[model samples]
Target: MHCIGNGGFFMWWWIASAAALAVLIVVVLLSSVRVRLKYYREGENDEVDASLSALFGLVRLRYKVPTVELKPWLNGIRMKVAPEETSGVLPELDFAREEIRRFVQRVRKLIAHMKNYKRFFADTLKHVHVVELRWDTRFGLTDAAETGMTGGVVWGLKSALLGVASRWMSFERLPSVTVTPVFNQPTFRTEIVIRTRMKVFRIIAIGAMLVYRVLKRRGGWIVWLRVLLGRSPKESTA
Candidate 1:
């Protein structure tokens, strides 16, 4: 009788431990993933910094892009220079009309993907909460009228972005914004910071939804693979 009682007690203890572990997992999964983003462009330099955390700061991560340089190119196209020093291993790069065509095709494919996956993304992003947002911009041009027009365009862009955010996510408070135009000088600068959060469980659910959506269609995996490769299967078929 003593041995049987001991075995029963051990079995109950194991069961209780298992239950406790499951609860902890659920709690962690339900915890919010906090995100912070900062992006800035001043004169010839721009960079982006981002951070993410979850489970009440038990998990944390950060990413930063130091800076980017841009220069005027032929045909009014701007050329991007890597922030790091060049290795000098590769030859000078050139762009042909074919490259421009390819870029346009890729953009079209991206738009199509957005249209197809609109529901999937909406379902995922609806769970997000906007904690804070601020965007400050200063721009100048030789002509005062041009500077004024540019500032208005920037304001419109900000308003559109905030409208989209409000449509998809819950906002804790109104966002702050500022735009200043300097007509006497020729310069451009902008800074943006935003904070948001979403539950880990919601993210998991979104992943599940993606998988289900992909599996539901014929040749979906192939299409998905092609999409990841920056090409469409129909392009290959043609």
Candidate 2:
């Protein structure tokens, strides 16, 4: 019996030894995995070959272009001045703010990813720069209907029908322009009138639609038909 017990004890000791050895091998192999590096830097002003230089050339090609001025204006009588600088700057400011916000978000995500991988960033990361562009614009609109046509020798008369379309409502007239600064980086302030006929129609249509849906839900087909026909149920009965 003693001999049997001694044999079992030796077997367990050997098994434990083998398990420990296996674990040690795994740990060593894991620690041996070194990050693969493409280049090493030992000195400043090191020359890069054509291939290496081309790798970073995309930055230059993708740089943003500056817009000196953007002016969208509506003047008296529906006369439009071809692309001039005396308009409004509010829209441009809004666009710039949105762009900068997105850029910052992207950079933050990139940094987080690098941190996750236990990686180091290039030295170029330190010199990142963002530039903003400013602009001045003006526009005019007149009420003369002018037209030109085509044939062997043809011409068309175009009349300024300011009241004819929604676009003309923008030319209601601005006696003088005023600008006031609002929140955010460069600040935005401008005085301008929104669109006319279209805006009014849009509001009325939306309100009517909402009322129609509500009535239809409560009264079913009877209310819906009346709404579509531009008549109320009470009016139809009368």
Candidate 3:
């Protein structure tokens, strides 16, 4: 009878220890974690001005078992722009066209970089656990002049796993922008907000770790194969 009792106690002790360890890991990850960014620029002669700000972090933790609940959010991304003073309608039209061209070029560059980075980080990214994300964003433009213009856009994404192994995971961005000449002063404004809840499963985490090991070794071979096939070496193997 005593031996049976001791065995039962041992089982309970093991369970308790595991629970404690899990809690400790979560606490460590949550401590001292914060991300923020802000920027502003104004021309010396008040001809042009712009500003932006953003923040991301955990807001709450509800539970941790079967799945861990994390309230992660990103918000307060705002921007504004004002046109420079110029004489003649032709000059204003030219300035607007130039600004539109520059904006398109920047977007193209950003997309290209994102694609390259995703390919470069493929191997390492595969090991990241799945997450449920709730994202939201808003964009707006305002104009109060001879050629007034105004518009706003909102976007949202939910419950996504990020990695090549997860064939369903995907991200896309489509932007529609236009510029027109203004007889008077011109102005533009935009705002974005995002909220998310992430849950990680033990099985998925374990699988990710195992996959990472294999990917670390297979990465070189994959690159070589792509080269032999006349494909870009940076292409994602997964």
Which candidate leads in TM-score?
A: 1
List pairs with backbone clashes in candidate 1: none
Question: On residues 130-171, what C-alpha lDDT tens digit does candidate 1 reach at each position?
Answer: 899989998999999988998899899989988987898788
Residues 1-238 of candidate 2: C-alpha lDDT, one tens digit per residue:
4455878988999999999999865544333111111111122211111111111232111111123233233211111222223354312222344444555654443333232222122222111111111111121113112111111111111122222322322233432222222222222222222221212233344445444444434344344455356553344221
Kindly report which residue stretches of model 3 are placed more than 4 angstroms away from their true locations once superposed: 1-12, 15-146, 149-184, 202-238
lDDT of 2 at 144: 16
TM-score of each: 0.72, 0.15, 0.26
Query: What's the C-alpha lDDT at position 202 in model 2?
Result: 36
Clashes found in each candidate (C-alpha, N, C closer than 3 A): 0, 20, 0
lDDT per residue for candidate 3 within 15-41, as digits (tens), equals 999999999777654443221211212
Q: What value of lDDT does candidate 2 attain over all alpha carbons?
A: 0.30
Q: Each model's C-alpha lDDT?
A: 0.75, 0.30, 0.35
Higher-lDDT candidate of 1 and 2:
1
The 10-residue segment of model 1 with minimum total lDDT is 75-84
**In lDDT terms, which candidate is top?**
1
